[model samples]
Structure formats: structure tokens, C-alpha cells
Target: MTKPHRHASHPKLVARLKRAEGHLRSVVEMIEAERPCLEVATQLQAVESAIRNAKQALIHDHLDHCLDADSSEHDRAELKAITRFL
Candidate 1:
């Protein structure tokens, strides 16, 4: 049987996605407004940080659920590989 994919339970994941969406919209606005390169770069960095936070939240959930539920040696190795990214 195939295992179910687990998702992060934190509200922060939703907030991160919303923030990214807003950031993208802001980027578009910046381009339209002819904003400075430095200002745009700052906004891009904020979006990158938000995405990283989302990734960490997902990794936390995976470690708690999928990693904990698996019993096989290969699963252990895969879990280690994934957790190493965190």
C-alpha cells in the first residue's frame, strides 16, 4: 500500500503562502511603478525567506509523521536525507 503524503498542520504555512502571493503582487506593482533595484531586491528577499519558512514547517511535519511511521531501513535513510535539509 502507498503511504499518504503528510502536510504541515501549522497556520504559518498558510500565512507564508499568502505572504508570497502578496509579495509577488508587490513585485508586479514595483515593476509598474519603476521602483529602484535595491527596493525590489529587498522584496524578493522577503519572499525567499517566506518560502524557506514554509519548507521548514513541512519538514517538521514530515519528521513527526512520515518519518515516525516508517519502519524500513530505506525509509530511515530517506528520512535522514530529508531531515538533513532542515
Candidate 2:
């Protein structure tokens, strides 16, 4: 199988991760400040959703670019690896 390389969507994926990181930091601060449990939970949920969306975007880009460059046999193996994330 070919090694994975960065694709056009990589920058967007990085941005999403950075946003999630920032949100996570905020959640930590909220906790430190003794914020309400519900408020902290809401922010945590946003972080989780951001991470999930980033993962989906990465998988979509990988399938689009990597699969197109590889053989059918390799594609099947790559697809199996990808499905494990889903």
C-alpha cells in the first residue's frame, strides 16, 4: 500500500482541529472557574462534534485522493482500515 500523504483538505482539517483545541482549552478554563456542570457539558459536546466532523472530513479526503491513486486491491485494504474509524 502507498503511504498516506497530505491532500488539499489537510489545511481545513488542521483548522478544525485547532478550533477544537481552543474549545477544549476553554472547557478546561470553565471547569477551573467552577462553571455550572451543564454549561461545561455543552462546551464539551461542541468539542466532540468538532473532532468528529474533522475525522469525517479527513476520511472523505483520503478516499477521494488516495483511492484514486492506488490499485483496486490496495483500495480494498485501505477501505477496510478506514471503516474501522466509522
Candidate 3:
């Protein structure tokens, strides 16, 4: 197998993941503070969406760079592994 190349968008994807982590921490803080259920739920939803978006971006980058570097057989196996996250 060829060495997997890093995607150009890797930094952006990492930034997004960091932002999602911060958002998750905020949600934990909100729960500890005993904030209203509605407010807490809303923040949780935002965190979830951010994480999902980050996952999608990472998957896109993987498909774009990693898959391009692989043979058809390897790509099929890699794609199966990647789709498991979805």
C-alpha cells in the first residue's frame, strides 16, 4: 500500500474537531451548573452537529487524498471501513 498522504484540509478539520470538543466541554459545564433542560439540550444539539460536521469533513478528506493514493482493492476495503462511521 502507498503511504497515505495528508489532506490539505487536515488543519481545518482539526480546528473544527477542537471547536466541537470545546462545545462539548461547555455542555458538560452547563449540566453541572443545573441549567434549564431546554438550554442544555440546545447546546448539546449544537455540539452533536459540530461533531457530525467534523466527521463528514474528515471523511471527505480521507476519500479525496487517501483513496486516491490506493489501488482499487485497497480503496474498496478502505471505503468499507470509512463508511462504518456513517
**Model 3, span 1-86: residue lDDT tens:** 25656778988988988998998999999999999999999999998999888898888777766665445887788788887886
List the candidate 1 regions with Cα displacement exceeding 4 Å. 6-12
lDDT of each: 0.79, 0.86, 0.83
Error of 2 at 84 (Å): 2.2
- For TM-score, candidate 1 versus 3, the one ahead is 3
Predicted model with the maximum lDDT: 2
Q: Model 2 lDDT vs. the true structure?
A: 0.86
**What's the CA RMSD of model 1 in angstroms?**
2.9
User: What is the per-residue lDDT of model 1 for residues 11-76, given as tens digits with 9 covering 90 to 100?
Assistant: 767877887989889988997899998999898888888888888888777677775554688888
lDDT, candidate 3, equals 0.83
Ten contiguous residues with the weakest lDDT in model 3: 62-71
lDDT digits (tens) for residues 1-86 of candidate 2: 47647788788789889999999999999999999999999999999999998998888777776665446876888788996885
After superposing candidate 2, which stretches have Cα over 4 Å from the reference? 1-4, 69-72
